[model samples]
Target: MQTSSFIGAVDIMSTQTATERPILHGGRREAMREAYPAAPQPWIDLSTGINPIPYPIPTLPAECFTRLPDPEAATRLESIAAAAYHVSDAAMVAAAPGTQILIELLARLLPQQRIAILGPTYAEHQAAWARGGGSVDLIPDLDDLPAASSLVLCNPNNPDGRIIPPARLRALADHLAARGGLLVIDEAFADLADRATSMAATLPHPAIVILRSFGKTYGLAGVRLGFALADAPRAAAIRTALGPWAVSGPAIAIGTIALADPAWLAATQHRLTHAAATLDRLLTDAGMTIIGGTPLYRLAATATAPDWHDRLARAGIMTRRFDDHPSWLRFGLPADHTAWARLAAALSGNRPPLANHPDQ
Candidate 1:
């Protein structure tokens, strides 16, 4: 299989003699709000696969606001995460504001190495590597990956939500290890349902690093806490790269509580499982194909994905649509049945009841 080169706005400068181009519109909340104005009831935000029902956040102690967190607070959070993931306490876990920070840190730490990335996945992984001065080879298939110094992949990949089997991923990791190459698994969404399938539980396989994020699973993206798990030395190396006090006090407090609550985890999993199945059936019944996903979200594609996205947005519903693959769309399971009905009606070309409202 031939690999396509991963290009970003920066690469555009290399080809064009022009000095500047229009600033790219980032998908920040402000921009999204402007592009899709909120309706009276608020637009349904299903663009992200974050948990619709986030772990309940408790009021923090006065110290959380009074001063910086004690160093031990981060350590305690790491310990809780390690136990939750069934990894060794000595595995060298460190928290950052989000997994994106960890990915950037890893990229900087491994600068000058040739990086191989699975494409049409998270744009940030490739962006981070490129920004850190690493040469990237974007491979479409695992077998097509070149013998590179580093590899990065998003398990249950984004946009399409296809999961690379754990056993197969391990075999690939072993292969990279044999070649003195590092394999980095971004398991940001793996906790949506399958924990046993995560490589993070048993990593530091000489050349393996795993990233886990609390944002998607616990719906704490606002708090922004995530972890990097590896063998002691590599973990220590990544920690050194991040330096001290990277995670905020509120993030540490919330992440620790969320990871430790097994009951919440179980309940969230059950909810997502049922919701995902329902979403799959609804899309299928509407003539769209539910091609892939885990329990967190469904990946569907039809000749209508682009138009459907526009139609839904006009109906006061927001969803994720991919530009690179115009036919594909990702839908996060809404917490309420009413939202699902709105989505189903939109997909079926039925005007939402609210369409007749004067406000709409």
Candidate 2:
């Protein structure tokens, strides 16, 4: 199931595995082409945690795209997002293009010598910290968290949905705060988690910063909306750093409407829960070991994961495959019945039905 790739740069056998797997982020259709040129068309991409069913975008005003985003309109969007997230104060939330922006800036916000990150979580946190000249330590166990100037971790983490309780996190925050340390929690997958798990509603602390990704839950990544929840001072500093019009008018308008729709939120959550259950069964039946992940995606462990990745790629069913953890494959929700059928056929090693085939 495992294969080797040689770069010949060094004779050393590095477990880094960058050559054996995709080194970049998922949903790379062009990379799929380089690997499997003869694969069939209509690729069913289940490579990201993005919701398969996106929020319905409303008709935008001409001014939204043509002119600069109004400060008042941005404020309105922040207010609505604050309400949706149960954040009491709109000032505590700083809107940006996406959570990725916040993640990159966090290292600079808190000048620290050592940054302890809980992993194998999101790769960006480590990369960002390293970029900002912080020595990064990867802590495998929660109990073994090292005393550091700053800490970064994910709540309901990516690749695998791992959550730490609010009370426990608060205690960690208190511990970090005593030593002038900062704790950055990425709650990107927290939407699918229970309401009690979110710390967004709670009073902000100077030592604690929470990041929420609107694109993942709302299925509007192109809208490029995300927020950083922190104390008044930190929020203000972030906003100042971002400057005016960091988010576009169209993003503000679309994000506001989507966040305000409680009915759509409830229905989508319900539908996603059911869909996740269906996906779990399919993966298990396909001879995979369920590892972790939320309703938006499922992480499965298999001995033949690399082979399966190649097999599915050849069938044009693109999934998120990890190089570091070679056994893991993350499957996002299929958009529709046809997508589901295609995935099932690919998993079963059967050619998809020929009707309307892209190559045919």
User: If scored against the real structure, what TM-score would every candidate get?
Assistant: 0.87, 0.91
Q: Model 2 compared with the native: what TM-score?
A: 0.91
Clashing pairs in 2: none
Looking at candidate 1, the ten consecutive residues that score lowest on lDDT are 1-10
Best by lDDT: 2
lDDT of each: 0.73, 0.81
Error of 1 at 308 (Å): 0.3
Q: Which number leads on TM-score?
A: 2
